[model samples]
Target: MSNLLSGETSPYLLQHAGQPVHWFPWGPAALERARRDDRPILLSIGYSACHWCHVMAHESFDDEATAALMNRLFVNIKVDREERPDLDQIYQTAHQLLTRQGGGWPLTVFLAPDGTPFHSGTYYPPEARHGRPAWRDLLESVAAAWQSQRGAIDQQGEAVRQALARTTPQATASEPAAVLAALGGPLQAVAGAWLAQRHDREHGGFGGAPKFPHATDLAWLLERGVAEGDGDARDIALLTLTRMAQGGLQDQLGGGFFRYSVDERWQIPHFEKMLSDNGLLLGLYAEATALTGDPLHGRAVEDGAGWLMREMQAPEGGYLSSLDADVEGREGRHYVWTSEEVRAALTPLEWDLASAHWDLIAAPNFEARHWHLGVVRPTAQLAATFDQPQAAIDEIITTVRAKLLARREQRLPPGRDDKVLTSWNALAITGMVRAAGLAGRPDWLQSARRAADFIHDHLWIEHQGRHRLLATWKDGQARFDAYLDDHAFLIEAMLALLQADFRLEDLRFAQALADELLDGFEDTAQGGFFFTRHDHERLIHRTKTGRDQALPSGNASAAWALQRLGHLVSEPRYLRAAERTLLLFAAEVAHQPGAWSRLLQAAVEQQCPPALIVLRGPQAREWRDALLQRCLPHTLVLAPPDATTGLPAPLDHPLPAAGGTTAWVCSGTQCLPPVHRLDELLAGLAPAPAPPTGR
Candidate 1:
């Protein structure tokens, strides 16, 4: 029979509502029952978007015999990984520690009644496949161990609990200059150190195999090099990005990135695509494009967001969680293809063009009847491979894709996690707003606004004269208050919406959200914000940390969000909060500079902010564009009092520029005189001339 999770809002929980295995959503009752009955807890965590999660469910959860066995011995507690990343982290860590390896989705933790983990692993198959152990064997082994070693397991649990308690946040230096200097002063040196330790000198990327794009570190190094005029760092970062872009890991035709490459040259990838990864990568690409004016970066971002909008964004306006790696119950089966199928699909001329473009040359990765997948073609060679002109080839490919897509639809696709997660939706909002600003797509901006509205209307609640954000959305029920990542990323989204749409309500809301973050989420004694709020019903314990994972740690993200909010509101307190957050992790960041690239980026923001406030008349479109042209490199243009809600000006940051289509350049607190001509504004903004260009 189905359990309480059936009525839950989380799509992950609801996905299992029809399972023969009786499951209970995380609650006091399940914990209490486990304690009273002295049964081990079988805690399963994998979101709705996970393909393997669906596989394990269909193979095991739907089977009556497996369900009966599971229900009889273990008190099964299921959780949506998206909703409780902290809990996931804690248990996943325990699992990995016990197994002498790593852990991921469909995380199965075998824990004692008192909640100490004895064993854990991810996704056991019904029968042995790929040389892995079978699910039945694993279940029986765990059950036997739990029964025989109950006392030993409790002692191990007690020791782990102590280690967890020891890691909670305690205040560090109230100021963060030590943190900044510690991180910034040695970033290049540390990056070089890490590279010196193991960089693949010839192939690019960091590791030996199973490569993931270290996009943030590369972007930071690029930014730093540009900031310092150091060419070597820039070249290394650019080369890495270039190779990845050309590699098979990139969906050359479809326009989104795969999860990670299994080889050094990025030939094959784990096919899941996440919204958070796209958002951060898009923002990074946009920055890269602006810095270098490289057409590839610009086009890649264009294609990436295009795929995001077309494939992922849900009907409810917010984007979906992910696209699974597997389709038709086989990994990469749908995406891989046979040469004959291609030959049948196109003419001889088209075949010649398509074959070369798709790299049908090296050796067909697929079998004769069933095509095994291989690497994609190099980007530089693709334009020349197509028989038709580049534009025509693109058109033909689009048409061809339509036919393939239709045929693929006939085969059931991987399951989608439709639940709108606040953190991930926040990521999508930023990406959409950035696309709208850089690519000049107002429709994208509108799309961002729709998501913002969804969050505000559906997830936020006002009670006791305060605003609280919810974490999950399934049916009608919304439970579990927002975490640090939610508030942090959402605040960034709020500011982004204001920048893109110039909406005052959004600005107001962003500030209100920031206030909530500062008030309750802040680690007032310790300095950086805590991941979970103090009032969050006291879980086993709170975790205070920062690291870059698929997204980033809530603490680190909060640090950047606070820094951005500081710029938006001209608030020094937010700056201090950013400082404290980074400093809290100063030792770790000092040790591994490359890992904390996000924190370092925020550190760069602290040094110099490109903040500007513009003032002009209602009919100031021409004036605004002119100012924008001059300030394109770095500047935030603001509207005059007349253009805005005409909200009462604060004494601290009054609107200083003159009215009636005039422009002023301000740095920090200094405002220059107004000018009517774009040339004059450019001259005022430009540095003193040296010699003639034709010397």
Candidate 2:
């Protein structure tokens, strides 16, 4: 029989609706039942694409005896972590505090009736293995402890609460310029060295075994490369980008990247593809291509963006969340291919080149002697090996790849989590806008606009005279007050979208979102923004952090976007809030630059604000597009509508009043001489000038 999760919108939740376990979707009802019966709450948190989540479910949740024990001993509650990041964040942190280890998906927590977690761990096996307790035995022990030693569990819960309270950074207020000057040079040196130490120089990516694309770290390094002229920083970023593009993290038959590689060599991936990961990495590739002019980076951007449009986009335009790592209850079933399969799919000439170029002749890279493809040699090298022209070799490889992809499509595809998230879609919009502006692709720009329109129509909301945003939308329904990430990321996206194709409505929406962000998420007393909104449901703890993880932290994104938006809109409140946030996180950021990658990016911006270039008159688009082609990391291009007036004072320049198309480059209302020609504009922007004085 279906449980309460059957009515939920999250695909992760619905996947287990028919499980033997009596699952309760997190709500007042579950809390009430636990409190009424004085029973512990067995809270299980995971997402649709989480492979280990599936493993645990099949082993334990599907077993009738285990389900009966879980139902009898506790008020069972299952949460889709993607949908309830609030609960996930709190419990994940608590799990670490209790166990002194990192927490991951399928996080199992034993909580008291009042939602205080006393014990937690991730992914217990059905039977004892990996030096971990068996699931049923663990459950019985927890239940016994709850009944016999209630006071000890309550004390442990209280201790966790105290630890959580102490997690917030100590409040500090420092001048942005002074902080940047004192710490900026040292941080760049330390961060570069830290990344160098972790970098597998022989192969790409960081450390050994499991490898995640540390997009934030690469982005910060690239920013330093541009600002400080650090060649080594640029080299690191470029090499990582190139290796990841050629590695198995990329879908060799199709497009887009899998989540992360299991080996340090980047030869094997975990197989799940997340929208957030691709969106952030796409922007990285686009920017890297612009900086290095590497055709390989450009190709990566094209393939990744193509994957998004082809497989991830919903009919309504917003991008879907993820593609599961498994198909037919087996990991990599849809992606791996045998030697015979590849030979059958390609021509003789094609197979000869492809087998050598793609390492198909190497020992099997996957279980059961199947292969997950990885680039084995350069195209030129392959061409020479086969005594064929490079162009001919390229054509053969392309033709063979298309055939393989077509045959792969005939297999059962991975499950897709189709729910559209506002923050993730905002990231996607930024990626598309960056790629479109760089390549001058109107189609990509339109795709970005369509997604933005969907967000504005469905997610942007006004409730009780307060403008707000909903975090997730699916099946024509939008719900939940948006988190700080949602508002901050959308504001950032709107700015990028405006630069791609100037739109009056997008600018207006950005202003509204920024205002709402300041009012709802900013901590007036503490300075930094909270993860949850001011009116969000109260949890065990409210968090405000600036550290970058798999995704950039919400607080860091808010501060960064607000700083840029403030300069463009000339809003002192936004600027003040941003400055306060920088000061709030300054101590930690200064000491640990590696962990604070996104915040470091924001601090750099605070120290040296981007040149706000406003264009006007007949050839504004032409001027903007020309400037975009060049790598200008710290310049914002805007061509506001002619009808728009009474604009922000920082943007109230004489260029709009001047005759013909003209560009005015300014740093906070101090304008350089207006240039009417593209050549003059280029010359003026070629050198990175010193920052303007006295605000």
Candidate 3:
């Protein structure tokens, strides 16, 4: 009854193990079988958390008659997009080119034995509806076309390959200084103005319905606001953060954010909570809190961090991937509530506060029968209406939330994808470390350290006399060669961890990972890193892009991390690679600066390097923590423990004066005089006075 997927580790693949379609996990055997049998390959790519993936599996993959047709005509191969992003990237592009439409999960493709796709679609219905072909009918038609039009299909596949090759950005040849100048100053201003133009001034996020949190872009705006003294940019980012915190997109009862809002008002969300999204948001809100000292941003960071620690983190240390959008057979069933249920869970006073605050007294907002809570009234307004203090109103609301959350916990919850992905965990570790520094949460820092330790112990391995990383670890097994994201994000995490709590082993690990990035993933001739490693199995196309998708661009992250590390240890090779990456993508970024937020950040840093501070002696951590209390977006502070020894050249500063802490500050390669006092160090690092305006 079980298919080839039964032996797979991915939860998404395992879900299809018992289907009647006899699914084969993506591998050489399936391709060989397809070639030997002279049948097309039915490639189905989706993740565990995809609702449509489940729907399609139930309606089509599980049907005996449909399975029989598929078994007879094609070699059905199932793929977890999260696990094999290489395959997903190649085919998703092919799907878009073939259909002239964007791609989504549950991606279905018909490919030749050589692995070129001829046809593709997403989520076909069992019976024809909504102007789409029925699943079985489509299958038979595709099979017939495969037999009758083999030559035409092969020709189209070649065209598709050529088009994909064209998608890769051609390397630009420019001097490093010229590249920096082109991507600097006026370019930043233009990009900021562009972002301002597209900003949804009335509703908060950028452009219309289905609003995503674009955490990287918001971070860019926040950084620009601080570094360049751009008030409008700062306010735009702050307003968006505030709206998302108050909106239904964030779970008001619990603490995490949903995948995205389905409406312009941020009132309805897709309901799945992903680690990658929350990780980026955690650091973003933490930075906002440090910048403005806004309690709203602080609370958002606290709540989001709490949700991650409480619900998502595994006992093994690494965080899980995502929470499913559907509960049982219905979407958002676990999170939505009826008015009766709310009233039953709370006392009268609490009910009054909750109902007013969450707008339960009005018509149901969800399906006309249930309510998805959103902040409709401020606590101050509720307090005034009740003739009570704001503190008293807040207490009542908090009590009501606790009771409701407890009751909701009794309901069947959405399924969780428990795979521990190296890249995602790295993102979370970086978030936790930064949030810990900002919020002074030692527990969060320890949580981050545990995850880092898990990755180092489990996923990191020595291969062919060099250290390498595995992408996913699940069911006590780590498999698949690590991609660029895995190395870049983890290296960044290590840097953040070192700033928070110095660890010699972590520094060493970061260096090893960086080496792996250069040796395995980097394009020495072209400059940017490829998505796949040099020795990775040959796919239709190898992606080397600078655009930010759901996650930040790997090339951008790599360049940023390498530059920071290079300056920290005075490594020219690392610095040169970073410069080359910026030069390679400089033209593409200049043409559409707003679209490349992450890369633009790397460019900004490339133009003006971040301040690097080295502290030595007894009070080092004390001074570092003091500086961390204030928002220093462009500074890196490291305070090696008193016992730390065998330091790198740049970190090996002279011992402290009179056994007290001494801070050595540097901008790029130039170091300022060492300061013995914290106040003096802070004063030395203060922002330069702005030039006087014309009288």
- Candidate 3 matches the true fold with a TM-score of 0.97
Leading candidate by lDDT: 3
**Which stretches of model 2 miss by more than 4 angstroms?**
173-177, 183-185, 654-659, 686-695
Give the per-residue Cα lDDT of candidate 2 at 15: 90
lDDT scores in order? 0.69, 0.85, 0.88
Q: lDDT tens digits, residues 1-695, model 1?
A: 34667777777788788787879888788888899988888999997657678789889988899988899888898888888887887887677667778888899888777677888889989998887788888889889988888678778777777777776656564355655765656664676566435555565677878888777667666666666666766666766666666566666656677777877877777777777777767766665555555556666677787777788777777777777777766666556667777677677766665666566655765444443333254323455644335566555655665555555556666556667778888988887777666656667777778888988888888868888888767554566888888998898788666555566777777778788888878887767777787787656657777766667667777777777666656788877888777777776665665577667666556555555545556544554433432214235565544536534232123333554455655555566666566566656553322221110
Candidate 3 has an lDDT of 0.88
Model 1 regions lying over 4 Å from their true place: 1-4, 127-133, 173-176, 192-204, 291-295, 366-411, 613-637, 645-695
Q: Which candidate is the best by TM-score?
A: 3
Predicted candidate 3 versus true structure: per-residue lDDT over 427-526, tens digit per residue = 9999999999877889999999889999999999888876779999998999999999999999999999999999898899899899999999988888
- List TM-scores for all candidates, in order: 0.88, 0.96, 0.97
Candidate 2, residues 1-695, lDDT tens digits: the string is 23688888999998999899999999899999999999999999999999999999999999999999999999999998888888888899899999899999999999999999998999999999999999999999999999999999888888889999999987765666777665545676776888888888777777888888998888878778877888888778878888988888999778888999999888889999999999898888888777666666777888888899999988898999999999978998899989999999888877888889888888999999899988879677887777888778777777888899999999989999999999999998998889888777788888888899999988878789866799998888887888888888899899898787777777778999988888888889878899898888778899888888888888888888888888987788988898788788878866766768787777777777889999888788888888776668778998876666776766555544545888888876567888788888988775422231210
